[model samples]
Target: MISTRDLTGLPDVSSLRRLLQSLAMLDAILSPDWQYRYYSFNCHWAFGEEWGSMRNGSGDEFYALFNQHGCFLKGFAHEALMTPCRDNPPKLWPGLFSNVPPEFSECLNEPAFDIASTTFCIWRYHDGREWQLDDLKFPAGSDPDGSGDLLSILDGTPETYYVWAEEYYQEAWNDTSGLTRDAVAAVYRHQPLSNELVSAINSNLRLEDLADDLRDIGYPNQKKPA
Candidate 1:
């Protein structure tokens, strides 16, 4: 695992931002390939976070807590609390999950859905060692997208493993606390007033539809919510 720490506060944050900016300038001048430049820039940020938090020892080191969606918690390591998100794509966070290993393709059972470009693995914790997606996380969520098999997908994978990391990103976007019912209806265009679904939404319930909020956001899907 590529480990790093989270640096919070204005001074550290500003320093990190400036450093990233400088790296970007260097990349533009030195590297011809933008992909390689971006990759190098991400590595620098990841390592800088680690070096900034050197006070605590290794076991209690204040590492950066990155959610499956690439949203990072500042100055604290909280990997245990991250929830798995399979439906949303991982590539949403460009450099964070940009490179996936070729070994991942070996785990596919349904060869069709396991497209070479689209598929990727999120991080997971097992007994003691870190296992690959093919060896660990993919078995559960392997079937077609909406087979009502989400729970099953999680079952076979290491305790809380999911296919992609962006599920956490969707969670952040669906915040409805400040908005009124009318406001939410205008944004969603779906029935926001239905008592049951609204109640579920109010209770912070996570169903397939809410979890996979990206599904119908762009286009109409004929299939019902599973």
Candidate 2:
């Protein structure tokens, strides 16, 4: 239930590049720690035309997207067994519901999907109330807006969500060691992680190490020259 409005204080995109650069430096410093290998420093995928992704030696993966519209982040516990579908989208909604909370089910209406069967669980937050989408805006051929989930209409920027995704992937890695394709797919289907779980995962990460590395890399205290 953590909404984008709650993360309004996070740094904006202008600072994101410097932050990512610092993360890369931290990744290099933490190379000996197997748990930290999945940490990524590159945000180029945030600006790519299509979904861009990165994988660690352990096979865990993170995906990101950014454009004129907004941004998005997706992480898989491990490489998915299924190939990216170019034609028929997989029907995965029915399978996903069994794992999610009942309130989330209340948010369900007419769900949408991509060719790869990635479901778009759209919801609206306005007037301090959440509303579910009864209809979807499926992407027409070559329509940029149609490409991803219906997030552009949401209230806040994607920066906070991006940070949450990074934390989520790190948690997934920490909670499980050898994730199968089925387990990874299950996470994709049940996209949102619990706030309690997020907090626990965040607590376990050695983010201070990254902060120290950022200082060493000339981004002391997350500040960099223009």
Candidate 3:
């Protein structure tokens, strides 16, 4: 287990605030009354493989395996999934993958996986509708279950997340100078699955003035932690 003690000097108020905003976003994206599940996969050393097992999905299917892998590769896979598919209206593209293998494409072609990894929170939006991994769709013949394709990138815990998070923060800070942007973006970049919370915070918050508030709070530059 990574000791909180080791994480002490990293960014305090800004990062914590971002963390709170993230959780709050989770609440918003997923209505409070909605049934939700959380799991982690990838580098077990960092997030712990046990985290993924805690969720309700059956490991017997490809989407289930894909979602688990997606969570572990959240930093990349989720972002990829979020990118809109230009060719298919309403259907989203998974992201920029180099040479997507045939096996993975096969799984996607048949809609074998309905929910993308980040899309698992759909359960929150659909009451009485349980989120199952099998509901997700992959390109035909795609091996959405391929172990080597993604896990290869998430071998180190937090390293991938941190790199993604850091770049995310820098971009948010540069685009809009303020506390809220930094806080919100920090969480969004790491765990975008928490969409509800982000929407709530953003509903009343303005990216333009966040920095000023952070400055008033004695946090220099109204920026979120790097």
What number of clashing residue pairs does each candidate have, in the order they appear? 3, 1, 40
Worst 10 residues of 1 by lDDT: 1-10
Give the distance in Å from residue 39's predicted Cα in candidate 1 to where it truly belongs.
Answer: 5.7
The numbered model that scores best in lDDT is: 2
Please give each candidate's TM-score: 0.18, 0.29, 0.21
109, model 1: CA deviation in Å?
35
Model 3 lowest lDDT segment of ten: 119-128
Q: Candidate 2 or 3, higher lDDT?
A: 2
Report lDDT (CA) for all predictions.
0.25, 0.33, 0.29
By TM-score: ranked, best first: 2, 3, 1
Candidate 3: global Cα-lDDT?
A: 0.29
* Candidate 2 residue-wise lDDT at 13: 37
> Which pairs of residues collide in candidate 2?
139-146
**Which regions of candidate 3 deviate over 4 angstroms?**
1-20, 23-121, 124-137, 141-160, 168-226
